[model samples]
Target: MDDTPTTTRPPRWLNDHEMRAWLGYRRMRALLDLQLARRLAADQGLSEPDYDVLTSLSDAEDHRIRLSELADRMLWSKSRLSHHVTRMQQRGLVTRQECASDGRGAFIVLTNHGMATLHAAAPDHVAAVREHFIDLLTEDQLRILGDLTDTVLAHLREQPA
Candidate 1:
């Protein structure tokens, strides 16, 4: 039997407007993330992943969450999160506690130091966000961007994993 797969039709290529939008979004995402990460590291001594993990724990109930759950929420693999958590733990930013109900499970708890660091860093981060991104857009543009993202995210969530 033949094993090669065949398509019924040729692929549709992106036109000028679609290509512009796609490339613009890619460039913007890359540049914005780089700028934000650099500012966070320079001013706060925190990497972007560190900030994300800290924020996730802070938002959770009692400032703690299961390691697996946190990994899923962050869309990170278990191993990656575990290694990162270990680094944060060494810094006294967070700690790991055994889950009593599950022998193999652990919880990542944000420490007081982590909370303090987040509080200290938040103002500067917000200022940088405003300076680099939010302030550049008009109210209408912001609203449209929000709507567009919501639409895209909704569509993405509807797809099979």
Candidate 2:
């Protein structure tokens, strides 16, 4: 028997409108993330990941949460979260305590310094958002964009990696 690769059907490509929309979305996302990170770093001495981790901890009860739960909430890999946590710990922004019930696990607790930093950073972050994003959109546009975001996010979540 011959062992040969068989040809499949041609790939489905995005048409003009779809292509424009997809590319535009990609560009906007990339630029927005870059700008946000830059502004945060310049104005508050915080990176985007720092802000995310800090905010997650701040929102948790007692400003403390398990490391695994934080990783899941941040949508970050274990290794990624670990490294960031270590860096933040060095900066006096957070502390990790061994879990009493789980010897192998730990909890991330936001420190007073972290809370102070977040409180200082939040207003500037909000202003940046308004300047760069929210102010540019009308109320109707904001509502439609929000709905579109939710729809796309839900659909993406249903797909396999």
Candidate 3:
């Protein structure tokens, strides 16, 4: 006969509705990411990471931003960003300029080639977004989803990295 004493409470678990909702969200996120990456690669000859870097540069003022800032914006480590930037530089998509003020710092400037590539890719990328995501939802659903995303983003930002 076993005579072990237990004082632990059962763990709180998701109920049926919550479980369904959570699983749906996970499935949707995964599928959307995969589809978007595949579309970017197949249609634009750019990997999702490459597209991300290019878009970030395109959005920055003067089509340039400090290398550290770029890494922060992309949530990539310094080493990873540096390696990717090196690859891009080799392709003539971007150039690394030494910061005049800070000898140790560098700026990532999108080149004409990069700008042209982004311009060419933008139309198809927009179409893919519309086809796979935007058109799938009603206006009200889109608004609600945006609000939900903002809320979640706020919560996430409040947490420690």
Indicate which candidate wins on lDDT: 1
Clashes of each: 0, 0, 0
**Local distance difference test, per candidate?**
0.95, 0.94, 0.91
- Candidates, ranked, TM-score: 1, 2, 3
Estimate, for each residue in 1-161, the C-alpha lDDT of model 1 and write its tens digit: 99999768877999999999999999999999999999999999999899999999999999999999999888899999999999999999999999999999999999999999999888888898999999999999999999999999999889886
Reference-based TM-score of each model: 0.95, 0.93, 0.90
- Stretches of model 2 off by over 4 angstroms after superposition: 1-7
lDDT of candidate 1 vs native? Answer: 0.95
Q: Which ten residues in a row have the lowest lDDT in candidate 3?
A: 40-49
lDDT string for model 2 (63-102, tens) is: 9999999998888887889999999999999999999999
Preferred candidate (lDDT higher): 1 or 3? 1
The most accurate candidate by TM-score is 1
Model 2 weakest 10-residue run by lDDT: 71-80
Clashing pairs in 3: none
Q: Is candidate 1 or candidate 2 better by lDDT?
A: 1
